[model samples]
Target: MSGTAGHGTVKGRDFRLFWFGETVSLLGNGIAVVALPFVAVLTLHAGTFVVGLLTSVAYLPWLLLGLPAGAWVDRLPRRPVMLVSDAVSFVAFVSVPIAACAHVLTIPHLLAAAFICGCASVFFTTAQRAYLPTLLSDAELLSGNARLQGSESTAEVIGPGLAGMLVQAFGAVAGLLANALSFLVSWISLRAIRVTEPPPSPPPEVRRRRLRTEVRDGLRFLFRDRILRTLAVFSAVSNIALTGMSSIEVAFLVRTVGAGEAVVGAVLTLCGLGGVLGVLVSHQVSRRYGSARAVVICLCGAAPFTLLFPLTGPGAGLAFFVVGGVGVGAGVVAANIITDTFRQRYCPPDLIGRVSASAAVISFGAIAVGGLLGGVLGELSGVRETMWMMTGMYTLATVALVCSPIRKLRDFPESDESLRAAEAEKAVP
Candidate 1:
């Protein structure tokens, strides 16, 4: 792979199809990001705490089901897991429109709906972590993750803007219908992809012993791996801050900055574009300066900028959007590449899902706390002060990583054979 943004070399055929499926699915997810709160607050008339809870509901499944989901994903057929998960999300989202049409949509019902969809997302994500490695070799992971991050960033930029306009134009309930349709589309796309995974080696004759052993083994290994431990810590602390920022985004734009929903959507979308650019360029940047260097630069520089969001002028909104997006994109790419590359290299094939889920549970669980704290911070300090504090949160994320040996990782995957040999070695002893 020459450049990031998926241009260097197209990866595995199965990966290509799988990537397309995920991209579409992410777009649908983006639609929900906009549609959910608006539906709760603007449509069903939810209070501030309720809105935060709605968001938290979406993340709760990760924390509650993480270990089990990971174990389950490891044991299942990934492609089918993906397809069925999307299908489940499809129905959960569609129910909103059906409920609204029937004039029966209410707060509790919506919460239940969001929780169900979130459950589906957990399965999809755990399966994805295991599935992606199967699609691309260690050599292609950087470019592959770049593409994935790029698509997500692009969706961040584009999807919300689209959601805002659609919600405003058609109403949030109607916009959700579009989101449902997007998931349906994603399901169809995944249905078409064919992948080949080496069958899992048979477990020992004792079933519960083997399963529980594998689960504990993954957790033990992840904690013992200095690199992954750092990644997990970095993910938790940084996400806590960022989630706080996310919690206050609407209030910051609407109350603090006095920008309307469309403006907020546009501003957020600009951040998305910056993220897309970061993802596209990160691979080359990693190659030129090294992945570890890129992570440090992004983490140190941009993470603090979250604090500066409230400090702006006329025509300055674009700068804020682009800079913030770039910071998020770059930091994420560096971290993911480092983590995925290492995990794929180090993790036993059987334990990938549990490790991935455990990591996510920690990260998203922090996000849940961050989002709640952000809401409280916004109400108490006002959006501007709260965001200024957000800058510190980003800084905290960097500091967490600063202590890690991975920070000095100057090169990636010394050699393919060597990388596999390392995995093989781990398997043997």
Candidate 2:
């Protein structure tokens, strides 16, 4: 037997439906990466600032809604939350084509739609993360996460290119129809899944139902101990650096290195390939180096590569670009695993929504700042100089290992046994 009882490749009917639905939706989201910005800049004639607003607005819900939404996810039936969120996503996406056809699609309306969809995404994401461990057992988590990583990486490798081709052929408006359809598909799959989720625990009295208690409990759960706090802070900083780099990477490639779109795409595709490869090998790497130490070394190795990105010449950029890709693909898996472990072990089982919301908000908030600051620094100095600056920023991100014992440690949590220990400590008033 793998993890949960009744195991096969399909993992039973519910897992199959749940997995396929998310895979479909993620692929479509991959399409949105290319489509959303295209529509914002080309179709809507937005300026740089408007584009920034669109991107940042898409993230704001994580800041404002993550905790409350997570609490709500814990309180409600996870499947219904998943279904309704998908439906909301579908409706939000459908309006894009309708407005485009009417020639009534403005940047503000487009942003509005994106904001709505993004908010729903926060909800659906919280529920899905919470929903997963219940469906599998301890032994199967490795293989199950591998499947997820592979699916996500596969989507990354192919989705953007496909989106670009689709937009070029069909126009961005029509391409978004694919995203809308993906959401509808996900909704139907959710409807088919059979799981007996427990109802909320508390009575609907004013005291336990208050927003403050919910938010406070979530925060405490997310940061109550050494492990969770270290994981959260490190992950947040690393993601910020990644986002900051993205904001400026294209400009650097174009102006500093004189690279074309073809080169940029090719280099990123290589990184995506690295991600696919990384997921395949993550378990082995965790075993060999110990998960936390492996992640630490990966982060340290990647920091210096940031400098290589800015150094111009024919071969220099290519070498650094490839190195960065490998680092990123592997690093992403490391971060995902660490954070997921923290959530799974430390958070109250019933409070996945709120704790995840806290994590999401912190992570995404850093991303917004990183993107903004990257753009600002690039404008103030030069792109290459800005890239060099990030080398130090990223190095500082790794400094958390020094603050937390995870840096010196060399072990995975023995099992979900650690999860129980963490929970007992938390039950202490």
Candidate 3:
């Protein structure tokens, strides 16, 4: 275990396999991010509100299934849960291209596909987060997370550009096929891993508890911790604004900015480029500035740049979107690396799934709300106006972090034990 868990080394075959598969899958997901909305706009001729509704539908499963899925994942073998999720998502996405080929692809069909894929994502994402700690020791977590996030960011760069070419040549629906095949690769890689995951060991009493009780306990654990609670609040608020802007981003570029499909892909690629740069610097920043401080710097510094997004125009004005997106992307990605590493190390292994799900439910639920709100506002006011509102809200959301106890700490507590020890010391005085 120590050999595999060494910092700055990627010697573990199991982790390598896992990383490869996820990187491939992430690339496909990047393609879908552009392709899915383009299909709605170009193929189905959906309006901005309807497109936003589609985005909301994709994330709705997280709000609906997040809590129970967390409890269920805790009770089951996590790898198997992830495998099943991959299978389900593959089937859901693959159907889209088939429907298009048959001239039977409707907006409802697209919605159903998005909803199904979202449901699978709720399970897969929760299980994947919990499973990572099993592969790497606490010392290796930051390195591992940075590697994974770096790959994801890189995929974000390559995938959109590739999707644009594919869409330009084959059609919007073709990108879904690439996504579906990536799922198959992920499934195979997971199947090949030989790591023997220890069975989940809830206390005998916990094993006998009702599922609802287990979920409540998870939520309780998260909210009871001041740092975690603060992080959750910040995530929820940030996601609402970010998702609102992203839900209509494709439409905004195509219709409002007058960017062609190829140009849209190029602009989106800048976001991934920023993410890669953030990943490269995250470890250094955390080491130099303290994890807590790094997070504050990222969020606070990035917030104002989002204002440039709504100011985008045709030729020279596009640079505003580019610079603003790169800033936001770098900030968000670097901050996420620190926070995710903290959660994995700090939370108890048994409660990881549930805690992660609880956190995600709040943030992702906000995403759903953002999507709907963006759509309604886009329809009522305008796409550009909605962008302004969302970006401004994103800038304001940082106040939640500024007001929290996080602002006072230099570094986050390492574990529940560290937090309790600190409290005990305070009480001794």
Q: Please report the candidate that would top lDDT against the real structure.
A: 3
Residue 60 alpha-carbon offset, candidate 2, angstroms: 1.1
**Model 1 ranges with Cα > 4 A deviation:** 1-8, 11-13, 210-212, 312-322, 412-429
Clashing pairs in 2: 4-137, 70-353, 70-354
Q: What are the RMSD figures for all models against the true structure?
A: 4.4, 4.1, 1.2
- How should the candidates be ordered by lDDT, best one leading? 3, 1, 2
Name the better of 2 and 3 by lDDT: 3
lDDT of each: 0.72, 0.70, 0.91
Question: Per-residue CA lDDT of candidate 2, range 83-164, in tens?
Answer: 8899999999999999999889888788888789989988888888777776676555556666777777777666666666
Across 1-429, the per-residue lDDT of candidate 1 in tens digits comes to 121234445555667776787787778777778778778767887655566677777788888877778877777777788788889988998999899989999999888888888888888988877887677765676567767876787778787788788777888887678778888888887777665565545465423465666567668867876556777888888888877777666655655566666776777777676566666666766778775566666566666556556564335654674576556765665556545655666566667788888888888888777877776777677667777787787787687677677666665444335655766887995
The runs of at least 3 residues in candidate 2 whose Cα sits more than 4 Å from the true structure, single-residue gaps closed, are 1-10, 45-47, 203-207, 248-267, 312-323, 378-385, 412-429
* Winner by lDDT between candidate 2 and candidate 1: 1
Cα lDDT of model 3 overall?
0.91
TM-score of candidate 3 to 2 decimals: 0.98
Clashing pairs in 3: none
